[model samples]
Target chain A: MKNIVIIGGGTGGTVVANRLANRLYDQKDISITLFAPEKNHIYQPDLLFLSLDLSDPRRMFRDEQKLLNKKVNLIQQPVDAINVDNKFVISKGKKYAYDYLVIATGARLVPDLIPGLAGNNNHFYDYSSAMQLRDKLRGFKKGVIVTGVADVPYKCPPAPLEFTLLLDYKLRKYGLRSSVDLTYIYPINSIFTIQNVVPILQKEYDTRNIAYKTFFIVDHVDPEKHEVVAMDGETVKYDLLVLIPPHRGQQIISDAGIGDEGGWMSVDKYTLQEKNHEEIYGIGDATNLPVSKAGSVAHFQSGVIANNISNSVLGIDEKINYDGSTMCMTEIGYDKGLILLFDYSHPPYGLIPSRLNHLAKVFYLDYYFANMMYGLP
Target chain B: MSDEKVTKVIDARGSYCPGPLMKLIENVRLAKVGDVLDLLSSDSGTKKDAPNWIKKTGQELIGIYDEEGYTRIRIKKIK
Candidate 1:
C-alpha cells in the first residue's frame, strides 16, 4: 500500500487532499492522511468583511473535520519535523511514514518582527485581530488613521488597499471623513505591486482624497510616540494605525531544511515540486512562488499539484503545469468591489469596481463556505 | 405579473450578494405553494443569482422589475 501524507489543512492542503482522495478512490492500495493543527478552518478573505462590520466573525469558520472528505484520515496535531530522507513526518511524539508528501502549511504573520509594532498597532491578518480592529474603529473619532504594509511578499496583497478603501467609506458614512486624516504607506513606489491596476487604484485614492506615501519600508514602530519609522529615515505618525505585518512560512518547514531564509519552501514555479526533493510538493502561501500568496493562488495551485501527483502515481510522464494565475476581489466599499485577474503570461487587469463585483465576492464567500471547504464540485 | 400580488416582500436592498440570496432561500423555504415572494436587492449579482436559484430550485420566476437604484425580483413558490 502507498501512503500519501499532506501537511497543513488550509485552502491548498484541503483541496489537494480531497482531489487526491477522489481520484485514487478506486485504488484500494492507496491511503491518504492529512495533518492539521487547527480545529476550525477560517475563511480568511471574509476577515476584511468582518473588519468592516459587513459580516460576523462567527460565520467565517467551520470545524475542519466536518470539511474534510470521509475517505481521508485526519490527524489533529502540530507537525514538529519532516525527515525527508526517511520519508516520514514527526508530529508530537508519533511519526507517520509516507510515499509522497504535500506541504501546504501556508504563511503566518510576524508582527513582532517589527519592533514595537505588535501591541500598539491594529492589524486584521487573523480572526482575533480583525475583531479587535473592528472594535477599535467604532471607538475612533477624529485623527490620522494610517493603514500600510510592513513588507512585501505578504498574503492577500490587495488586503491593505481594501482596508483603506473600506475605512474611508465607513468614516464618510459616520460623517467624520473631513475630521480624519487617512494615509496609505507602501514599501514600493507604486500603490500596488501589479502595474496595470496601479493607475486605477491611484485614481480611486485621488478621488477619495486618501493620501498615499510610497517607498516607505517599515523598520520599526515607536509606540510611545505614536509613530512608525521607515528604513529610509522616513517616519509617519498616526492616531490609529492598521498594519499588515510581515509574513513567513511555518517554522517546521525551515527546521526541516526545506525552506529558505524566510521559511518559505522553494519549489519549481510551474511544477510545484520541491527543488531538491522531487517526492515532495509545495503549494499556496508556504511555497516561494512568485505570485500573490492569496487563497485564489492557492486554489489554482491545488489543481496543478493534484494532477501532477496523480500523473506520478500512474507512471505517466506527462504533468500539469501551473501558470501562476491569481485573482483577488478588491472591496472598494459602499457595497462595491472589483476583480483583479493576472498570471505569469498575462499582466494584471482591473475590472472596474462596482456593486456587481461586491456581490460576486459575497457569492464566493458562500461558495467557499458551502462547497469549497467540503471539496465538492 | 400585475394579476399576481406579492405575498411577502424581502427588503434586501442594502444587503450584499449572498446575503440577499441566502435571505431569499430561507424565506422561500417557509413560503407556501403558489405564494408570490418579492425580493428587493441593490446588489447587481442578485439580479442574476436570484433568478438562477429560482430556476434551479424549480420555482417560477414571475417578473424582474428594474427600479431606480435596486431591482425587484418576483418569484412564485411552485415546489
Candidate 2:
C-alpha cells in the first residue's frame, strides 16, 4: 500500500484528508494517515463571536477525530522530528515511513515571542485562550478593550475587525458601550487586506466609534502594568487586552529544512509543492501563500492539491493548480456580516454588499455539522 | 421522490451558500414530514454541501441530480 502521511489536523489537513479519502478509499493501493498533537479542532473564525457570548465555544469546536473519515488513520501526538533525508516521520517515539508527505500543520501562534504577552492573563490563540478571554470579558465592565493583530499574515485578516465589532456588541449589551473604550490595533495601515473592503470597514468603525490605530507594530506586552507597548515607544494602557499573536510554521517543518525566511513552508504559488522536495506538498496556512489564512482558502486549495496529488501518485497528468483562492466572512457586529472573496484569478471575483456571503457564512454551521461532523461517519 | 414531485421545482439559481439551504430550511419547516424540497444550487460547493447540511439537521436526503449547468437537490424535511 502507498502510505501518505499528513502533518497537522487543522483546516488544511482535514480538507486534504477528506478529499483524498473520497478518491483513495476502497482502493487497495493507498493508505492515508494524519497526525496532530490534539484532538480538538477549533473553528477559529468563531472565536471572535465567542468573546461576546454571541457564540458558544463548545458549539464552535469539536474533536478532530469526528471531522476525519474512518478509512484513514489518525495519530494524535506531537511530532518530534521529520528526517527528510531518510523519508521518515518520527513522532510519539515511533517512526513512520511514507511514499508521499503532506505538510498541512498550518501556522503556530507565538505570543511569547512578543515578550511578556503569553503570561497568565494573556489569551491569544487556541480555544483555552479564547475561553480565558471570554471569562475576562464577562467579569470586567469598564476598561480599554484592545484586540489587535500581533503581526502580518495572521490567520483571518479581518479577525481584528470582527473582534472589535464583537466587543462593540458586548459593550452595548452590558450597557457599557460609552463607558468602556475600545481600540483596534494593527501593524497594517488599512482595515481590510484587500483594498475593496476598506470603505465598508471604515464606515463600520466610524458608526461604532471604535478607534483604529494605524501601523502600530506591537513590540511586547507589559501585563504587569496593563500596557501594550509598540515598536515606536507608544504605550496603550488597557484593562482588558485581547491580542492576536504572531504565527510561524511548526518546528518540525523548519527542522526538516522546508521553510522560507519567514519560517513558513515555501512552495510554488501555483502548485503548492515544496520548492526543494517534489514529493512534499503543502496546504492551508502552512504554505507561504500570499492570501488570507482562512478556512475558505484551505478548502479551495485542498481541492486543487488533492486532484494534483492523485495525479502525481498514479503518474497521470497533473491538471489542477491552485490560484491562491481565499475568502472570509467579516462579522460587523450584531447580525450584520460582510464577505470578502478573492483569488489569483486576475478578474478579481468577490461580493461585498451581497447578502449571499452572510447566508454562506451562517450556512457554515450546517456545513460544519454535515460535511465535517457526519459526512466522514 | 415521486415522479409527480420531480416536476415541482423551486428556482434557487444564483443563490449562494446556505441561501439555497436556508430557503429550503424555511420551506421545509412549513412542509409535512414526507414533503420533498427540490432545491437548485449554483454555488460550487453545493454538490456536497446541500446533502451534508440536510444530514446535520437530521433531514432526509432523497437525491442529488445534475441538470444543465446546475444541480437539482431533492431533500425530505424531517423533524
Candidate 3:
C-alpha cells in the first residue's frame, strides 16, 4: 500500500488530506495518515473576526477527528523529525514510514522574536491573543490604539489592515470612535505590501481619520511606558498596542535541516513538491513560495498537491500546477469588503471593496469554513 | 460546452490564478451581450474561482471542461 503521511492539522494539512481522500475514494491500495499536535483544529481566519468581537469563540474550532475523512488515520502527536532520505517520520520515538510526505506545519507567531513583545502581543493571530485583545477592546474607552505589522513575510498581508479597519468599525458602533485615536504602523513606505492595495487603504484611512507611520520598523515594545520604539529612535506611545508579531516555521523542520534560515521548507514553486525530494511536498506558510501565505492560498495549493499526488498514485501521467494563487477577502469596515486576487504572472488591479464582497467574506465562516475541512471548496 | 458561437478564444493556459479570470472579464466587457467567451487555463485556482466570479457578476458560466493538459471554461456575457 502507498502510505501518505501528512503533518499538521491546520488548513493546508486538513484540506490536503480530505481532498486527497475524496479524490481517491475508490482506491484501497493507499493509506493516508495525518499527524497533528492538537485535538481541536482552530479556523485561523476566525481569529481576525474574533479579535473584533464579531464571531462566536466556540464556533471557531472543530474537533480534529471530526474534520478528517474516515480514510485518514489521525495521530494527535508532535512530530519529532522528518527523515527525508529514509522516507519516514518520528513521533514519540516511534517510526512511521511513508511513500509520500506532506509538510503543512504552518508558521508560528514568535512573540519573543521581538524584544519586550513576548507576553505583550495583544494582536489577534492566535486564540489567546484574540481573546485577550477582545477583552482589552472592551475596557478601552480612550487613548491611542495602534495597529501595525511588525515583521515582513507574515501570513495574510491584509490582516493588519483589516484589524485597523474593523477596529474602526467596532469603535464607531460602540460609540468609542471619538475617544480612541487609531493609527497604523508599517515598516515599508506603503501601508500594504502589494502596491495596488495602498491607494485603496490610504483613501479609507484618510476618510476615517486613521493616522499611519510608514517606514517605522518596530525595535522593541516598552510595556512600562506603553510605547513602541521604532528602529530610527522614533517612539509611538499607545494605551493599547496591537501588532502582528514575527513568524517562523515549525522547529521540527529546522531541526531536521530541511528548512531555510527562517525554518520555511523549500519547494518547487509550480508543483509544491519539496525541492530535491520528489517524495515530499509542502503547502501553506511552511513553504518558501513567494505567494501570500493566507488560508486561501493554502486552500488553492491543497487541491493542486492532492490532485497531483492522486495522479501519481493512480499511475496517471496527468499533471496540474499551483500558480501562486492568493485570494484575500478583507473587510474595510462600514459593511464593505475588499477582495484581492493575484498570482505569479498577474496582479489584482480592477478589484474593489463592495457590500457583496463583505457579505461573502462573512458568509465564508458561516458555511464554507467548516465544510472546507471535508474538502468542500 | 455547446455548439454556441465563440466570439473570442483566450489562450491563458500559462497564466496564473486571476490572470484567466481577468482576461475573461476584459473580453466580456468588450463583447456583445450574447457573445460567448472561451478561457483556457492550466492554473487550477481559476477553475474554482471563475464560477464564483461569474455568479457574482450575473454572467453565465457555461461549463468547465477538463481537457487533457488544460482547462476550458466557457462564459456568456449577459447585460
lDDT (Cα, tens digit) per residue for candidate 3, span B1-79: 5888888776667655544654464355446889888888888877876786676556798888999888999999876
Task: Give the higher-TM-score candidate: 2 or 3.
Answer: 3
Q: Highest DockQ: which candidate?
A: 3
lDDT of 2 by residue, A1-377 (tens): 78889888887788788778876777778889998778788777776666666677668767888778877789998778888878889987899998788888888886666787776334435777777778877788777888776655578777777778767877888799888998888654466555557788788788889887865666678878888887667788888777777777778777889875446787777788899777788888887655667878787887877788777777788567787666677777666677666666432245454455666766676575466533332
B-chain TM-score, every candidate?
0.95, 0.80, 0.93
Candidate numbers, best DockQ first, in rank order: 3, 2, 1
lDDT of 1 by residue, A69-158 (tens): 787899988789999989999988798999889999999888887898888888888888889999988888889999988765688988
True-vs-predicted CA distance for residue A27, candidate 1, Å: 1.5
Provide the lowest-lDDT 10-residue window in model 1 chain A.
Answer: A368-377
DockQ of every candidate = 0.01, 0.01, 0.02
lDDT of 3 by residue, A110-169 (tens): 878679988765888889878999998889999999899876558787899999999998
Clashing pairs in 2: none
Clashing pairs in 1: none
Query: Distance from true position, residue A366, model 2, in Å?
Result: 2.4
